[model samples]
Target chain A: MPPRPRRSYDQFCAAARALDAVGDRWTLLIVRELLLGPRRYTDLHADLPGVSTDVLASRLKDLEQSGLATRRRLPPPAAAYVYELTGRGRELTPVLRALAAWGAPELAERRPTDAVRAHWFALPLLDAVALEEGLVELSLEEGDFHVRRGSDGTVSYGDGPAPDEPDARMTLDAGTAVELGRGTLSVADGVRGGRIAVTGDGPLAKALRDG
Target chain B: MPPRPRRSYDQFCAAARALDAVGDRWTLLIVRELLLGPRRYTDLHADLPGVSTDVLASRLKDLEQSGLATRRRLPPPAAAYVYELTGRGRELTPVLRALAAWGAPELAERRPTDAVRAHWFALPLLDAVALEEGLVELSLEEGDFHVRRGSDGTVSYGDGPAPDEPDARMTLDAGTAVELGRGTLSVADGVRGGRIAVTGDGPLAKALRDG
Candidate 1:
């Protein structure tokens, strides 16, 4: 890409330059949707209802100009265009995650849902540093799941296979796993309370309880 | 504030919530500006030369509603007002700094300064976790500055009278510091070559050079 003219150092004193690029309300949200993966224009429109078609087009154009997003055609004869993040746009993920973490509590208070409740646990995964420290093994049985804790407090998933050296194993459905990650329930507490079952090493069970 | 009505799980989504709030281009920029300090409407307008008054006003309103910014009257005449970040708004400072760091190189290449350059260093002080380790003490004398490194590299600055125990003390004007930070000159090489001077503890001075 040809370089654009440099703005004066004094120009850096103002926040406008950054804001002008992503300051608009719709643009970042559009960027956020794209982060989950790419989607066609119609998918975006459906996802962001109440946004006028013209405004969406304009925001997308502005995003493209700012080097945040780009559009590409998909499929045969469909001419369906999808927008995806460029490298610059992906950089905003941490910002979006931080904002979400800050707002999550307030949002949960206002809208109590099974999914919203689950999000409380899962959202922290966005912080890879924290995730690497905390996660242990996850194991699934016929309808139950087990969680084992490592000495370092990392949780892992172990299930179903012929691995004799297992930490803690539980059996649960996929939805339950998703919900547990989302923070909907305390997996350790659930097992202790008999809402779930655990069949594994005692230390691992205790660690899961502690976690 | 009264509790808000229950929202659906989808509403808790970050992008959905952000769009429900500032979702336009100008509001985030407005938040960014306030982070440096508060500014009056006219000052903000000046900073964002391209944004029309109507759009600016709309963005301000959106920001106010989102709890990211608060507009306050500056005494005497209620007609005049300044916009400042709320606590929630100030949380975005790191995000803004990261974005600035990512964008700075590209911006510098495109727009080289024409006049005498002023150097500015904005390391994140409150959060040590955000910065890389390195402590260098700098002192100015006769339009030149000297740097000395310590055993532990924890960067800090003090604006008081000099202590008797400084490892090394070199002096230079602000412009030179700015230039060095921008990679225009190597601090170690400059000192060794006598383009810059070094006095006091040689090991500390050498460490600063290494840094």
Candidate 2:
């Protein structure tokens, strides 16, 4: 493919240089999606609703050019293309986390015109959950999702139900979920106050309830 | 002023929301400028070269609408209009700092076409300086500028020479300056190794050399 034009601020400042790479509209949001794991083009298109096909393609190309993401094809039975972050791209985790924390208060109230998806809550809640190594199924009015903290210290979340029986299931109202995600309320406070109903007999469930 | 259209990823995620506000090109760069202090429209334009008049005006309006910045008139003798970051906008310091630290590696080499202003180094170097409460004049090969750590703990920098006799003056090459700003080289290390020459007899200079 021909290289798309490279847009830059052209300043020597580090922050300006960083912005030159990932500061465009929907670029970081695309990063947010890829951060979950590799996703097929269709998967990304579906998750990121309202993004025009052109913009998505352009941003993905930009990411590839910037060495933040790459396009790869699966082998054998799953011979499909997917986009994933590069090691340099994965380094954006902290930058995304910082932005997520800073913009948490903005999520206190959702606008009527706003569009939300199940996994949109994943990043913030990932930091809120204390499970060392377990799959956590979360149920909210918006939708159902699951969070997993691996023994290897990697955390990831997905939409809908857990692929397997979860170690813990948390059912809570949207308000409580928003507060917890905003970090205004702790998991212990929610569990003790009965805002979040924790279920399952696993150690993760027991630890959450004991909090 | 009329409200410009607000572009959003429409996702409920906090990072997405932040990108909604600051994800636009030149927005965070403008935020970086305001972090230094308030400035007139002309001043911002001068520092931020290559930004079209229309885009700059549009971004300033976007910032004002987002409550990140505001415009106000100065008193009497110099009754010029200036833009400054609101308290909420100032909260982006950490966000900018994170981006700066992450993007520091990208600044390893200056592109031939890169445009740089003296004050561009101010923000990154702000965190590198060890002055508790004094004015620090930094002389780089690009140009000279000053950073001040006020008694109130507020830090600010300006282009050109110090406004008054500065408390301390340090002269260094652009490479060492970039390393120090990137946090790879410590101030003490720079001083001890003579990469940075500490020149003033003030307490700030004494402390810097003792390191």
Candidate 3:
């Protein structure tokens, strides 16, 4: 492969520089997908419904060149290639959270042409959940996904529940989760109102109840 | 104008929903410009050098329809239309800050074609500064700008020092400011080294020193 030429904004400002790296359409979203852990190209394509195959491949390449992601082959049994975020790339959680919170009001209603993903709600719900460091499993009507925030402030989410025993698990319906994103309801309020159920005996559940 | 349709990603996820709203080309960059308060169409055009007139106008229109920005004629004496971010739009500070921080490492050098703005560096410096609720003014070689965070976590920044008396003032040379953004130098270290001058008896300067 030839050396990738850098075509940054060339501006000194950090925001512009950052945009130069991830400002392209579909780049950050790719980062959003990979935050779940390593994913095969086909899995990435399935989750990111609207992106073209060419664009997806191109973005993965850009992310690799940008040092935000790395591709590796699964050994033996799986025999597949996967892409995953690096530590620097993982720093984007706060950025995604901020963007998701800012854009939540835009989702008042779903369009007929729109696509749905259950794990997509993870970042916004991150703010709604307790700040305690633990895994949170959410069993929504549409599908299941889980979110975990570490003590160092790193946050990651993936499809289904925690791989290990989750610190806490919540069986929340979609309506309650959407309402929480809309700022119309709180987690504690949802729990109290029976809109959301708590199943873990961790500090997270305790915090949610007290909140 | 007929009711501008809301073409949302019918996804249940907040991050996807956000991308549906702000995922368009140059949208967040426009948001970056508007964060400096308001700008005349001509001003926006000049600052956003590479954007074609048509795309800039179209993006501005989308912003207005999305309620992220609005246009109004300046009163009487200096009558002209200017676009400004709504309160909801200004909420992007943290998002922008996160992005700037992530992108800071990529600013290895400046190219000749790059246009430099003193204020363009503000977002990155925001994270470098103290978390106190006060305005800090910067008089750099390129231009002037100010940033302030409110008690409620609301942050607003603009082209110059506080319109009135700023809570604090700091005169930072370009080199020192860039160093701070790059994570190589601390604000206190700069202040102590005389590369950054601290002024005013406000809590901000005190915090910078302690920081």
Top candidate (lDDT): 2
Task: Calculate the i-RMS of every candidate, to one decimal place.
Answer: 6.1, 1.4, 1.9
Task: Give Cα distance to truth, residue B82, candidate 2, Å.
Answer: 0.9
Model 3, A1-211: lDDT tens digits are: 7966856655677787888878877888888889889999999999888788999999999989888999999998999999999998998877788888876776676667767778887777777874688888888887888878888976678897778888777888766787777778888888899888887787887887667
Q: How many residue pairs clash in each candidate at the backbone level? A: 48, 0, 0
**Candidate number with greatest TM-score:** 3
Tell me each candidate's TM-score.
Answer: 0.52, 0.86, 0.92
DockQ comparisons of all candidates to the true complex: 0.17, 0.65, 0.66
lDDT of 3 by residue, B63-163 (tens): 88778899999998989999998887777777888888787766667777888888887877876764588888889989888888889966677886668
Q: Give the per-residue lDDT digits (tens) of candidate 2, residues A191-210.
A: 89989999989888887777
Measured by DockQ, the strongest candidate is: 3
Candidate 3, pairs of clashing residues: none
Specify the poorest-scoring 10-residue window by lDDT in model 1 chain A. Answer: A113-122
Error of 1 at B176 (Å): 9.8
TM-score of 1: 0.52
